[model samples]
Target: MSSINTNKKNTITWLLLLLFTVISVYIGEVLELFTTQKSLFIGAVLFIVFLKGQQIIDVFMELKYAPKLWRRLLLGYVILLPIIIGIIYLV
Candidate 1:
């Protein structure tokens, strides 16, 4: 029973990640947001990336039950990534 549930959850998570990737590509190419809304484009992409990172960490890595220090460190890394990317975009 547990195995089936876990498999289902993993499948859903994978699908969501794929959808996010498609959305990012659509934003970058189809929408051509970079030409006028560079900041918005970056913000949208970073937000999706952050969500994707959290999904991977919690679901795939199974880190939700891990020690507080370890979990926090991983989450902190995920949170920090967008900040770094945003800074790079600005530069």
Candidate 2:
């Protein structure tokens, strides 16, 4: 039963990641022509990237059940990028 649930969770994660990838691609390719707000789309793409990073860390890395310290160590990098982007944009 546990294995079945894990499989289901993994499948769902994979699908969600795929969906995010599609959305990211759409924003990068299709949406650019329709919108003039470059920062907004860039921010949206960054948010999606952050989501993908979290998914990769927690699911693909099998760190969902890991120790808090270890998880935070990896997640910190994922979390840091958006802040850095924000800083760059603000300056």
Candidate 3:
């Protein structure tokens, strides 16, 4: 029964990730529609990137059951890298 529950959870996680991926692609298409002021579009995409990364780390990596320190480090990297890149992009 535990195994079955785990499988169901994994399936749900996968489906949610797939939905997010589709949304990301749609956002990318919409971004192309903007001829000027791309910063907002870029920011939106970066946010989606962050969300996807967070989901991957938490669900696929099973970081939710990991040590607090390790989870923090991995999740921090997932968040910080994007912010750094965004800052670089804006400068």
Candidate 4:
């Protein structure tokens, strides 16, 4: 059924995201590969985690079915909010 296939796809995406999360954490923490590097690497990894989390929220959390404006607002809150705050703090 269509719903069944959709569920499978969602599951796979989540698994992939989980795998990436583990890799990112391991590389950033256990190996300490990111500590000495620019914030770029850690930021990128965290950004990927955020993106995956957003996708999961959109799909499994049913945010995707919302109105376009609401979705954009939600994404802005999730993505841009931190950057704005960080910049403010830095300044």
Ranked by TM-score, the better of candidates 3 and 4 is 3
**lDDT of candidate 1 at residue 44, scale 0 to 100:** 82
Ranking by TM-score: 1, 3, 2, 4
Best by TM-score: 1
Residues 8-80, candidate 1, lDDT per residue (tens digit)? 9999999999999999988878446347767778888888899999999998999888888887999899999
- TM-score for predicted model 1 compared with the true structure: 0.89
lDDT of 2 by residue, 26-73 (tens): 998866888887787778888898999999999989988899998898
Write the number of the candidate with greater lDDT, choosing between 2 and 4.
Answer: 2
In candidate 3, where is summed lDDT lowest over 10 consecutive residues? 32-41
Comparison by TM-score, 1 against 4, better one: 1
RMSD of each: 1.7, 2.1, 1.6, 3.1
1-91 in candidate 3: lDDT tens per residue? 3989878888998898888889878877877686566677678878888888888888779888889999899889988998998888878
Per-residue error for 74 in candidate 1, Å, reads: 0.8
* C-alpha lDDT (0 to 100) for residue 51 of candidate 2: 97
User: Where in model 3 is the C-alpha error above 4 Å?
Assistant: none
lDDT against the true structure, per candidate, is: 0.88, 0.88, 0.84, 0.71
TM-score of 2: 0.83
Q: How high is the lDDT of residue 25 in model 1? A: 84
Please state the error at residue 68 of candidate 2 in Å. 0.7
